[model samples]
Target: MKSREKAVRMTLVAASCVWLFGVPFAAHAQSRVTLSGIIDAGILYANNSGGHADWSTTSGQLTASRWIMTGSEDLGGGSHAIFRLMSPFNVQNGHGTGRAFNVAYVGLADDRFGTVTVGRQWDTTIDTVSGFASNETWAGYIGAHVGDADNTNASFKVSNTVKYASPQFAGLSFGATYGFSNQAAAADGSSGFANNRMMSAGAAYARGPFAAGIGFLQADRPDAQPAGALGAPGAGVYDDYENTFSGSIASTAGVQRQRIWLAGASYQFFGALTLGGMYSKTQYRYLDATALTLDNYEANLTWQITPAWETGVAYIRTSGRYSGSGTGDAEPGWDQINLGTEYAISKRTTLYLIGVAQQGRHAVAQIYGVTPSSTRRQLVVTSGIQHQF
Candidate 1:
């Protein structure tokens, strides 16, 4: 294990050196490094959660507060080397106790060929079709589909991954990624082929005022590891990634595998209004059991009332189906509405307001990062501020 760890570390060091110093001998390359991030916090009111009206201070209601370091160097021949190191934190507590870099990758890019990178990073749903989903694009995790089952809001990042993105061709682009377990055998010294692995692929199109995307993702054993294991140093399988949004199926629900497909599209009108819609289906296959399926539908509109002010409203419907051995089929559904507005205080700062109302039928209400409601209804209202640099 130590030998493997040392090897991976050495490889990363070499790659970093190449990206930093491998410029052409005489081309006079130019390099740039930028520091950037967002900080957001607010007060939230919930009508029902654990059977009570609750009020609390919240962080990342509009965006996950994060800091990032991004750099790129021109390598001549229209190619460039790039890298990113991003860290996410809770602004309210000002503590970063988990993984050091939420995203860490090194890659090369060319206008004509494409780009390839390796590290912990987002999957295809987040890269492609998620852009048209209000919960992921604008409304935040609080507005995400039940348990974020489809990964539009990204339940977790893929670790030990290599990714490739193709250059656009006539308004079309495509990308894919693979995640590894980093271990050769299971605890019992057997092949770990079915333990931990992830893969995703997606494509997108944009032309004039219309854009659309489609994506597919599959992940195995996201929560196979126990708690108190994610924050440890060195390399581990599935432990280094945070799967906070996967509670519905990943938290001892006996889920063994997951698969998702999503598609979305949007249209712009008169440079002031945008309309978008998305659809997704996620399947949860359990160990020694049948499977569960979740279907989600969403539509939203964003209106730019002015250059500094904007508002968005969206509606979502989610349905779940259960199928198991010798068991009757059961179906449950949930409906949600989300409303939000943002006023730009400056180019890098804003004040925001958001509200969501959800109701479930033959289901329990569960919003991301919030306590599950005892009844079938939940409502959340939040007012906050965000700043970027």
Candidate 2:
């Protein structure tokens, strides 16, 4: 099956090349393939890791450590054949994550029409609106809002996906994605789409110093683990979703559907400061009407203080609604602040220190990748160095 898919993609590229003939050159046709990635490591100090203050070595505290290989061929007539394979890993354990690749896709790009890709890929929510979150722009792991309840992190990529991105029109652009279920009716029966499936759409506008984006995502039976697969069911998306709910929320393996709405805007001031704000609402629905919902609001700012030094601050507030019985009936929320500084030693290497503080209401303070605090307050600090190639 995999070979067949690859053959089909290659055929598409061949057909495009034949149709285009000659025009402008592709971005990297002359170069062919490019290899690049980022590696970062640091010491992480958390006032509470699983109810205890601790210190440990970690990786990807600042940016996801990844390896990427991309190739492009000029199809002529302003068309290009492109393919990319990327994988993010844990620098600490030297282990890669999220399927074989964080992204593995083949596509055709044209200056006039747009781009279309097939394979594993991110949803529109992450592509369009995640940039406004501090988790991506400034603070890293500690900056994720209430454990990334909005599902904006790249940690969850949809498998079996087809995506289309339109060319910009007057600084406006839009895109869409669809992920196949790859399941049989005899196995996953209910709604026609009552299996591993997804549909997502997003739009963005950028002009001058201002930019804005909005995105929507929906998935059904997202916890699917097909037959003959390893580990427990719902390995990828479902595990991430459960972890995002933190300690107080009830963990359930029967998530029937998931939906998300995200919006964000940012502006640059004096070419030195950037200010941004974002909002997201995520719902994990099960049964008929029961759903676990989280709403996140965030404001973040970054300032370039000098040629070699930069600083940032982020504040996030999250509110949740739970409908289950027992402790789940009581709603929970949290407020968090992240502060960070980075000093560049060279163009590709930098040192960073970031601190995070979180106060949870009716729950234990929990940083995204860390364990929940025994108390309602938690503090974390990480100092690291990053190198890029």
Candidate 3:
């Protein structure tokens, strides 16, 4: 009888072990995939020139429309591998923005070793600093600084890159990324005709209700147009023509170089209300050809009313100083104010309103010229509904 009891107990133990291992393996094989996206459309009214009159119907008017597919697989040992493919589209015309793989990357993550990813992805500056209170919460102008001065909207995403993020430890974490130029012969000094090549790095810290970060980016020979060539008529245009003329005089004239530095912080004061601000300065040097500097300041506040309603207001100012053989030390400036509000119906649907006004000074309008009218002051208002899945 004793021998028979011992045999039964050992058999039960073996059965339990098989069940435990098989259950996890079966679940891993059944891992799920999810498809999600957001569609935002609305009407806009602007007291501006030429584009669409004072009032017109606009789609994707307030927030961009996007679709994404993401999946993950358990790799055992408290680790997982994941991938995401994001595509942004223009809902108004049902046309693709050509960013089908806006964010296509794969990565491995573990509780102890953090996460590492390769392929196109957002840099540290955008992932950390740009999501704070002063940044855009629901794709509105009011949330970001003037013209997204600090790139709070992540206007540019690094390509051909590899990135790593440390697991959150004591409310503090950091991330870094490196984008390869992918040139066949970067060291040979012969392959320098790429349209875009950039490098960026940043660090961040968050403790309780306070967070702060700083970062820098450098690009070689990036495109620099006259200040007048952007936005409205009175906007700034690239100094390209002048640079060309100057280059003729000196064969070794320097090309355009762009560098940006940014720092920002946010703190929660009461309830769901938070105050945040950021400052960024950019310098454009024309390689011993000419020089220009742009200074930007932004401040904003975010208030969460109820669980589904939020409001944001922001002010931004930018000034540009031009020096070198071309401008004779003339300076131009522009300022803008933005306001935005959003209401959520569910985790995947939202309604938003945004308004912006800007002013230009000096030949600044001529400097920052726009395709529309080059007026000194411009105002725009947009209201839209967005659905996310």
Candidate 4:
């Protein structure tokens, strides 16, 4: 009788142990924090039509180096709280902590409802469709849409904003954002910095292998000029080649507004190859002035040579036109071709090579504030390695 009783107690203890530890372990497995980052560094060489051969070292030739921290806590009943903080940096010098300008936000997520975020963030057009083309991968310097003409990749981050994103269903999702001006009225009974406020909104949808999106952003011109000039005649306004120049006349004075539209599609041809293309356009309007329009198109192909090796080729073209009082009918345009290859040293490291060449017309001439000459052509070659953790 004593032996039998002891056996029964042992069985009960084992069952209690399973019940006490199993549920908590399963829940912990479903919630966790992840730290991820990438580092890309490379050497670069450039040749220009002016008989200047420039050899320079470069990094992040293929993709920007960045670090991200993300976490999610399950609230039970198919709901959760989530947050993410991502920072992009210059691998060469290890400075610039906020390339995305300090994206820190918190939101509630649900399996059925969607998500809402309040803080500094990117707009919908960029989050839905950017860097889907080969040009972004192959051409290092020439890939951006002519001065980031469209801001398609969220190159322009929004501040003091509230945003909402819908849950993806059947491969389709949508979102919108609003930024508050937060200003006080002026004594002249006129709007002061209040006029300098901004507002933006956008929507997007995706299904299967196709995606499309559009967004509009607007900002008021401050009476006081910021240090830099926009669309200036002799300044490297968009290229970041020179220091900020001060001017009295606001290039985008009054009310500044921008509208962007984009569409893209990708398809897998076989087990190892994929093809994709994208088109985007942006129109900028200055208070009572005619609009300036910029157009872009890109196409690319990627091939997997082996399980760990890949190569790609891409082409991109862009055109810009100005319509207003003093501007002439001349339009500028540029063409770029790029080739790139990559080998995965491991799951966390990669080596890459990229070559890019660009030829510009009237637009390229204005880009450098120089007369139109074949000497405007630029070629760049780069090779680097990247590690992710």
Query: Among all windows of ten consecutive residues in candidate 1, which has the lowest summed lDDT?
Result: 1-10
Off by over 4 Å in 4: 1-31, 49-51, 97-101, 135-142, 185-255, 287-290, 365-374
Q: What is the TM-score of each candidate against the true structure?
A: 0.86, 0.86, 0.77, 0.75
Candidate 1 Cα outliers beyond 4 Å, as residue runs: 1-29, 225-253, 325-328
User: Compared with the true structure, what per-residue lDDT tens digits does model 1 show for residues 33-146?
Assistant: 656677879999988879998999987788777776777788999899999887878888998636678778899999999999988778766878988888765577788888
In model 1, what lDDT does residue 285 have?
Answer: 78
**Model 2 misplaced regions, further than 4 Å:** 1-31, 188-193, 227-242, 246-253, 287-289
Candidate RMSDs in order: 7.2, 7.2, 12.4, 11.8
Q: Between prediction 1 and prediction 3, which has the larger TM-score?
A: 1
CA lDDT, every prediction? 0.76, 0.75, 0.60, 0.58
Clashing pairs in 4: 332-363
For 1-389, candidate 3 gives per-residue lDDT tens digits of 00001111111232343464463433345244456566778887666554334676565544456666666777888888877677777788887765556668898989888889987777667766666524345435333443343455655566667888888888777777776555444345566434235566777888888988887766554432211111111114212112211221223454455567888888888878878877788776666767767687777788888798987777777777777775668676777676777887776677878776667765322111112334777677778887755
> Residue 354, candidate 3: how far off, in angstroms?
0.8
| Error in Å for residue 271 of model 4 | 2.9
Q: After TM-score superposition, what is the CA distance of residue 355 in candidate 2 from its true location, in Å? A: 0.9
**Model 3: lDDT to the true structure:** 0.60
Q: Any runs in candidate 3 off by more than 4 Å, and if so which? A: 1-30, 50-54, 59-62, 133-135, 138-149, 186-195, 223-255, 363-373
Model 4 TM-score, 2 decimals: 0.75
